[model samples]
Target: MPFIPHTEEEVQEMLVAIGAASIDELFDEIPENLKLTQLDAIPTALSEMEITQLMGKRSLQDGEPSCFIGAGAYDHHIPAAVWQLTTRGEFYTAYTPYQAEASQGTLQLLYEFQSMMVALTGMDASNASLYDGASALAEAVLMSVRANRKSKSKRVLMPRTVHPAYRRVVHNIVRNQQIELVEVAFDPKSGQTNLAVLEQYAGEDFAALVIPQPNFFGVLEDVDALTNWAHANGALAVGVVNPLALALLTPPGLWGEAGADICCGEGQPLGAPLASGGPYFGFLCCKIAQVRQMPGRIIGRTVDLDGKVGYSLTLQAREQHIRRSKATSNICTNQGLMVTAATIHMALLGSEGLERAAAASFQNTRHLVEVLTAIPGVEVMFEQPAFHERVVRLPAPAKGILRSLAAHNVLGGFDLSADYPELGNALLVCATEKRTEDEIAAYAQKLERVIQLQGGVTCGLVPKE
Candidate 1:
């Protein structure tokens, strides 16, 4: 979105028509001290042509770098036909199918999305979508508390291995509602949540237990054990999974004997880009019994008067039309556009294709770890098996090493110092299927140079196993 300048006369005319005396009146709610008097850093007005030229020159300053950071959003390859088909007028301009008859195409697309999610997660039902992964987790936490009729306590066992931002969002959304998020610490050595810690809460009445497949540190957890443990204590198993990883890893529904009650995760890797942290949608799925508790729109396939197959909004017990008390959640709008794109992405890449991509990602990450650890003083931080991302300890401060890598046109990895301070200078690195052997080698070469520049101490190479 480009900035369009307005004429003073046009601005004044618009302001007068809107019942505002001046621009300042519109922002009366903003604190007097907080409002900036002027933006001195902003350059003077330039012609469109001049601005375009200047932007081109500035854009070149930040050369294209190999991406290795996949904390939440990934850098997976989207097929060419994905966006091409998604942007078609019929799909692009379609809004929520409030009147199912008017927006059948949109409803149908959403239904397909839900069906695909069900197949992927092995859940009985799926909602259209919520805002993003973080908000989706908040909704899942809330849903667990409401659906757990057996448990009296609103406590949910949230492991420290869950995404930090997601934990914060869950706390903010659920705390006021008296929902307690009990934080469970991870194993310092493996960067995984051990069952021994979970044993402490064996008899406690908790509404749910969140189990991340490859947790925040990217270490794969024992999902079957965790899910079974949650069920043994009469708690709902809430799985926060990576959709891409679900291609190869066991899904939430197959985790234990009964499987996870609810599953949710970010749908960004499906088709959405890392367009400045995104417009990514979050998907929520649950068993048939818990379908009534799931939030967001749920589209159902049905027969018309003519006995024609059709799509319709189903089990909607939330927002504007429903009574406040009866509503499951306050999720207002649907992430229909993102969901549509993801559907197209999945359609283009069938299950076999997704599995291949997942396998490639896992192999590449393992190879990357092997390559990176070969360097002196650089070692794998965790001893557990991981998916595409893993935490690796750098000999020097991660931030400085990352900055140096950036100068060499490489995005090394995400620095986890501030978030996980105990793991000093630990860098959370990822190598998706998109990363080639050459790219991985280049990253390692530049990283070694950076370490040498920092006078990194030479040490015996630590085995990645």
Candidate 2:
């Protein structure tokens, strides 16, 4: 029932009926310190029309800028029909397929999502989805510790080249699980994981080694060497990948003579957009033997009683569904809406279209690097081949230059100094297929102006930390 205003007589009668002298007496059991005296910070309620106008004005502040900033989340062009079809009442409002009989449509879509991810990663099987890329990687690490029979140690080797945010998430989630994470350094010159350092720890009693392809620096790693080394040492090779890059680069499953045991990555590049930070899904794929250890839910195809084809919820290892101790993961729900969009996108753009998109992104990124490095004080940090992102050493602090660029309505790349303080004045920039020649030219011109205005420091000299 809706709340209605009470008359003074009725209020007094209710107070008398409840044996309370005043409204304040109703809360006599509560402590004084726990009670709020006034709400000083909250503003007075505004009219609907007034609020609508205010919100609209603020929304305009997020207008499309010439975006180049891609640390992990990317700006990909999502088709209009993708969301329109995904957000239908049936798909958008559907809940988890707890009762498989009524959720055929949702289950079928997720099955398709799994099939596409498996083909892309060249893995044996894939789960429906997970929270996001960071948590997915964390879950994959936890799975390795349980599934790997050769090494019983709780130690995992993590490369510094992995996205710092992902590393932090892994630590935050698994730190209390008695897992030991050893940090491996990257080669300063090539911006790849230091193979010598990795080799040093390869023989250790580690359960898994986390390798990032087109690592956080955007430089491709020696996947073949790393995968072979990890497997030879009896540790599972966990590949943290960018799904789009798989179209052009080698898939994780084909990394070495053996193959990567597990693969996890952000699925945003496939179909999800950079909605500020996200609403993106994470995909996890692994060998068939490790399917039981995989987290979240997996949809499987089968035949009905009459021998007709159908889809249903298959593997669910969540604590909520199974015994707590036996559960492989505690992840509650998959990002269903995001997965729906991703599946539709992959279907729309078949294998050929995906490859073309990945190739174009690589070309655009190379062109962007060439233009940025043309400036007197700008220099590319790594000579190794990269995908869609590159580290460029800047004369001054990248944050300051980026701020200046923003005034020109350009979203420059991420400031590496924030996460990688050792990098000094480096900025990690990306150029996706969505970028145009005009946008790249404009970014170059604006960047050159910023460098000159800031009194271009010597080339190759980063400002001292």
Candidate 3:
């Protein structure tokens, strides 16, 4: 809507025509206690140039910090065209697709999103989208329990290597619903799930087993073995994956002979920015046999009366429309806006472009590990091959070192002491393709200088370019 400020004369004429003396007289029905009569907190409005200058000063105060943390949200480079096209009025101001005939564009976009997710995860079908990665995993857990007719137990074998925050969310959401999350431990050496410990529960009945590729510690897991074992025990294999890593790693659909039954993961790395925490959508895809059990809305493409191509909502399980007990899920609306950006991002960067970015990220992470380990007391914490992130053992306390790094305008990796106390003084670092060689060297130099200082030590700051 365009703003057209009224002239004082025009306003007075309108007031006279309405039999009012002033604008305040038009609201005479309001009670005295309901009105606010002061504007003391607000400053006088400034001119355009003055406001622009003031904002520039504020932007300078908020320095552009270098990002090396990728616990769940990533800092991948987005193509300029992705957001440029997505933010156009047609896509940006769109709302829910309640009317199929009038909402063809929105419905088609969602249908394309599902198709892309199906291709990426190698699953039979995919819903529009879910809340975020953590909640999606929680939903996947519940879905597996309901879909597994072979096992009556609501027990799920959850690996300790999955993201700690995700586990907390799952427990909070499903604990009161009679779901039991049995945590499986990891091997200290490889940072991978211990197959020996898993063998102890060979014949036990469980609904599903969650397999995280490049588990929380960033170490790749034996996914094929885990998937096979889950199937042998009459359990469904649910894969918690990173969509970007799927460019180089094996898709969950081909994990074993019969393949993983379901796959779910965070979609931040696709195109969404890590603005503080997120606005990223979670993707869930499963085999055709269990499509009815999936949550959220699914868009289906079909031919109309004139043989025209069309898209419409299918298998909607809203609580308002079905019996309370028979409704498959409580998921109502899909995250259409976030998924729109992801679809554009994936389309711009075809399969080959995504592979190159993944490969570059892996190479940069490997190089970062080497550069940091060259310091006298820094070393890799795990022996298993990792993707783009790794847990490094630091000589000094991780919390203090990270605080000191922030002073240098560098946002270091996450400290694992609070979550996994067993790995004492460990830091999880990552190197996205965005990190330049100069940035890596500067980080190493500052880290080495910080490690050498016992007491109060003076260090030079390296301003970010």
Candidate 4:
């Protein structure tokens, strides 16, 4: 891939050798209609320095926006060493381990990742990793249907409290299939999945019930009651969780009397930086019996002929591995690099460090809620116990307030109108451990100023009846 400079004389000589007058003549065999006569839309090429300066100036427009938005992706502090070590040539350039014996290092790392995920979720087994949280949830839905041998139903109950993006991805992926995805509404006051509506739909005809922990609105669902209800109705309970929250809250596997059948979530909060939305991994864990139906690769540890320990691909459900028509899943590879980053992050922040981080995030969010709610026209919308994010109703439209906050270099959470239209002028705000006290205060000050200038009035806190 080294650059080679060709001279005009060299080109002319080559053209002459090929019996062509010019480069255009070389492609004379091609039809004229197929050839592009011009590319006027593309800009003229610029010098290296000019291009660099232009890019730098454009990037400066982004400024230093204090992020409070956490609809799904978060802004968490990542240790520098996590990527420093992960980017090593050995780990960076490694590819799919088709030959399991030859990929001991990769297999071992993935095995460790799976082990950590299982321990974190309190599940019997974990897959290597998946495309992302949304797709992982979709895969979890498919697995639930497959695992529910007793049920002849293809219906799944998805909560409105789940991230709208995640739900959309699931619909797009599974819409062509015969499966029916039923939406369960949430309590407008509590912002949690309405247990009343849930009870009506929770029955034998449903394949699974997808529950989001510290759901899209950042309101914690009554997971115990929901899981128990799902079990009682002979439906699999699929918990869409936040991996970081598991540090302080109870794991899905330990929920209810019976426990969640499957657990999956976004792992961006682990150690991955929010590099403009992504490159984050998704994790899925399940009971031991459902391991066979799980998607993606699974690495396992065993002993060799000489009694030496070895690591290899334990199960590959993708079409590439097994019979194409009979394959359990079509996912060929796991998000190896992201998994590597997450494994290192988990190791760096052991159990105690993770607990501290989680506790700090919760406290920071509470602080944010207090300061923001003190504003004249701001109020907390939900009374439920939340982890590190909350929903707040604003007198003015959230979109307008967010734009005003951006003018002050602050990203004031996500607007809830589009997703939850009934929650008028609401915003989903988060304060991870990375948010400083000063940032919270500044956000409050900016928000109050914005609301005042807009002549907005408060409805105060709604009665939690």
Q: Which lDDT tens digits does candidate 1 get at residues 1-465?
A: 147588889999999899899998999999989988787899878888998999999878767689899899888888989889889998888777888898998999899999999999999999999999888999999999989999988999999999888999999999999999999989898888978999999999999999998898889999999999999999999999999899988989999899999999999989998876789999999999998888988999999999999999987655546747678887768688889999999999999999998889889999999999888778899989999999999887899999989988899998999888989879999999999999999999988888888877453434334
| Residue 29 displacement in candidate 2 (angstroms) | 16
Which ranking of candidates, highest TM-score first? 4, 2, 1, 3
Q: Say which candidate scores most in TM-score.
A: 4
The segments of candidate 3 whose C-alpha lies over 4 angstroms from its true place after superposition are: 1-61, 318-326, 455-465
Worst 10-residue lDDT window, candidate 2: 456-465
**Residue pairs that clash (backbone atoms under 3 angstroms), model 3:** none
- Candidate 3 lDDT over 1-465, as tens digits, reads 126689889999999899998999989999979999889999987878999999999878868888788898878999998889788887788777778888898889989988888888899999888889999999999999999999999999999999999999998888988999999999989999988898888999999999998798889999999999999999999999999999899999999888899999998888888877677888999999999898888888987899999998877663325535677667766577788899999999989988998989999989999998887677789989999999998876789988888899887798999988999879999999999999889888888888878332223322212
Superposed by TM-score, candidate 4 places the C-alpha of residue 89 at a distance from the truth, in angstroms, of 1.4
Candidate 1 regions exceeding 4 Å error are 1-61, 458-465
Pairs with backbone N, CA or C atoms under 3 Å apart (clashes), candidate 2: none
Q: Against the true structure, what is each candidate's TM-score? A: 0.87, 0.89, 0.87, 0.89
